[model samples]
Target: MPAYQLYVYEDQEKREALEQKICEQVDACTEVNGKIRNRVKKFLIEEGITDISEMNAALRVRYEGYLERNETVHVPITCLRGFDRIFLHRMKEELKTLAGQRKYTTEYRDQWLCLTHYPDVEVAESFLTSKDGKELVWNFTLECPRKLKMQIFTVLKEVIHTYEGWTRKEKLLALQRLYQFCVVNQVSDIETMTLEEEQKFALKLSEDLGEKKKNAVFGILRMSRKILFLQAPEINWNANVWFLERFHFSKERINPSKPVELVSFKEVTNLENQKILQKYLRYLFGITDLCISTIRIKLLELRTFLVYFNGEEKPIYEVEAEKIQRYLESIQRQDTREKTANGRIFMILQFYNFLVVKRYLKKIPFRYEYYLQKEVHVHNDRSVPEGVYTEILSKLAEFPEHLRLMFLHLWCTGIRGSEVCTLTGDGYEEKDGDYWLKVYQVKMKTYKRIPIPEALYKLVQVYKKKYQIGPEEYLFQNQTGGAFRYGTFRYQMLKYCEKYQIANGEYIFKSHDYRHNLATLYYDSGISLQAVRDYLGHEYEEMTRQYVDYMPKKLEKASEAYFQEETHSFAAELMKGEFHG
Candidate 1:
């Protein structure tokens, strides 16, 4: 058999009365029919009672009546004392409305009693204890102790007297006057007052305190206290003082007789030794305030000078070269592992050559030969073979809409992922009757444009509509609707591939693969190498040839057809015999 159910909407005070009525109705073995049933049903109907879903008498009688003969029904009751009756009534009405709207029947049962949804508990308590529920409780109960009755009478009298004594505007003026009087009397510390004193003070202040004056007084007091703390002698010992000290400068003596000269590094041996020395000093001192690229460039220059000093025709002695090597080795060993020791050494060697060949430094060192030989081993690892382009493209097709668009943009255009990430609406332009996305290559500091595809254009239109893409908003915002981070995008791509079971092949599908794919596809389609280079926005044709060589079948065919030995020999013979001089 299905479970018994009951449904009722009653305010807190009425809840107990209703429950008692239900119990009496059940105990009396009342036969609900004809005139009696009609009277009860009419009362229920007038009270807007509909289906007995939560508590159904008929269902309860059929299923749990036998249990009722041996047991008692228990329903927990919580008295919402001092709560607003009108609010509770409205809450009941809302629940009923919801029940009616959903067409709930006798099959389900649920109950709730909500007081208020105010965020602050204190405010909710204050509103609950206000005059709103007083009359509703009074109507149902008259028996009370004389003291309670007298308390109620006094409260009502005070409220009525206050209301009748002054208009709202006059009360506001009185509040301002009272607040001013309190301020003059130095009684602003409300905490010092007893509860009764506070009540009296509040009543008096309510009549005279102006909202603006109260706010101004509070603001002035708060600011004055803050300023006093700020001006204290101990403020110099605060954390902020140390932070500001970072920017402070000690007085330096100026050489008034000799003016400082501005000269290019190129003019001074085509190298800035002082800048290199500063970078080395910063690195040694663990200072990271300098730009990474600037530090790298300076390090490279220092290495070049060291290499030149060591690798001159008149080589530096073994002792001197060992000293230089030890200094560099010490830096390498200091709290950091070198990922590419060979690369570091190669840079050092290159810098040495620049110093020597540029006539900035002199001598080849015999001890440096061992380091050079050791560096060659680091370069022996074979480069990974390019992964299948088709596999990457297929996987990219299944990417989420936004990422798919990004991949498509990358694939069609040979632009780097970083460049694509920084692409904005401002980069798009109508160039020679074609819509193109302009990208500035950060590494190269060069600008180029890629034509937009029809599909991509449509996708962007929908994206703009959904995101309400403003003129200044990033095209690809993250989940929280902010610009996508490069690290986040890369992490997402890896996770996506892993979930989809894409093979981790020789070449991982990095952002640069898109450039490779674009170049390979265009080259294989019989486009001229020079034209392909121009399309991919490569500054040099030699770089484009790298992609051309990757497509060995196409390269072999072009070599056989255009540069055959027979063709070359015939052309040479014809040139030798052709002139009718």
Candidate 2:
């Protein structure tokens, strides 16, 4: 590998000296065995080094004997996987030639009759077995290259290693179809392949499979596309080579990015304010690195402040700290939570900072700490009264069993709605005679195995049997098995809100209220607050404290744990017991 790098090394005269020594071998040697140059090339061939740039620092010491006293050293570009940037161009060229595009089009349609049919041609087969054929095989792979001829075959190996789902048989068939698809169709780089070409190939595979063979060939083709998407950027071509006009892969695997809207501030009606607002938002998006969702949320908050100051800034750069304070006071009139008010305050302060940095404002605005609302204790209350919890459960029972299990899974495990949507039918597990609910907590990016009560376990079992759902399908899919996104707690509450409402839908408790109910009740039943914190996946005990309520000291006086038995009443069930639900 080191010797091959020396071929392209910038010091042309010195690299030529090393190349000549390797080519001439013993004849170019000053020493008896000519071991240095001979051994370098021999080591590369023996080690099966295809990408010579993998020549590491330690290996460079082997060439130390040949180094001139003050020569500058170069950095190695190869990654640990032996992926060399230098090999990219040559690999594409070699693959294009091996796929025999010019020969295939010229000969398969016109020239070498003996070899045009490929592998079956006897005289061609004889030539392939000769010395030139031997070189062809060696150049392609360390493996038996005749069978796996294209560069894409090596790429397929990488895909199989990373694909965690498939079995050995499925992968082997995928490989067979991939190699045949590449060579016969003359595809060198699959990432640049068009949608029409992919569809045509998929149709051909379906015809060949017939009724006798199972048609899983499409999976292999998609696998090839995924592999191309992942590896194409590693080469020096167009960085967006993998992007296509079509999206053929799984939406779950790759969530399609929301389309970016083109905003025109001209609709603001005030010309000066529109121009300033446009430039400010454009500057915010361009300068700061934030995800689109976070930026959009911040931008909306900024818009509220802008609307409040609508005609105040005639030239769009005027400021008054008293007016900004009045805006904050108006927001508090809506009974906004302290956290939400703080978020708006945060955005306003940042917008002022941007204006100051741009020199548009000489000096302006109130400091964030001065206008802040006094702490709203009501937002900290996360628990419902025991009677309300019982009512919610009874109302849920009136819904279908699957819908009921959705609430049961969230309430029992204390996982969020986003995590619940991803739960599979096989998420239930038993170990050491105890059932565990597998919870994938998306926010914390961790998994939790919350112990399940028999009531909840039985409820899930009934749901599976009644619905005839497979263990692998999504937990919350529709009756026909289409997935509904877990957008918000509104997905759970809206339908029942009117029935539960004391007035308008404003007073309805959210699905997350069940999380708070469990956290508080668990602690009330003599469970430690630290345990509740861990179960809730809170970053700090302080956040968990916000979720749990203050339990009366007298509630801790019980000799036996109230949660030991699953009940049918207020605080009826906790995480323990074996009663059939």
Best by lDDT: 2
CA lDDT of every candidate: 0.44, 0.53
TM-score of model 2 (CA atoms): 0.42
The parts of candidate 2 lying over 4 Å away from their true place are 1-296, 312-339, 354-365, 374-397, 442-448, 461-473, 478-509, 552-581
TM-scores, all candidates, are 0.38, 0.42
Clash pairs, candidate 2, are: 107-111
Query: Across residues 1-581, which tens digit of lDDT does each residue of candidate 2 receive?
Result: 59767776756766556555444532332332343334445544444443343343233333333232324423111111111111222233333665534423311121112111232233223322222111111122223334234335444346434433335335545556656665576655554444455666777776887633535656665555555555443531221122222323223222112322222232343445555665676665556544444555666676666666666646546646666678877766776777777777778778778778888887656667866777654435666566665666767766655556777776777777656667778889877889988766544545788888878887778777876768877767744564435543355456664565523445465667768888888887889989999888888977787777664333454314554444533254433333445
lDDT of 1 by residue, 434-488 (tens): 7777765544446776687766666676777786787666677666655565566
Candidate 1, which segments miss by more than 4 Å at Cα?
Answer: 1-319, 322-398, 430-433, 478-483, 503-507, 549-553, 561-581
- Candidate 2: what lDDT? 0.53
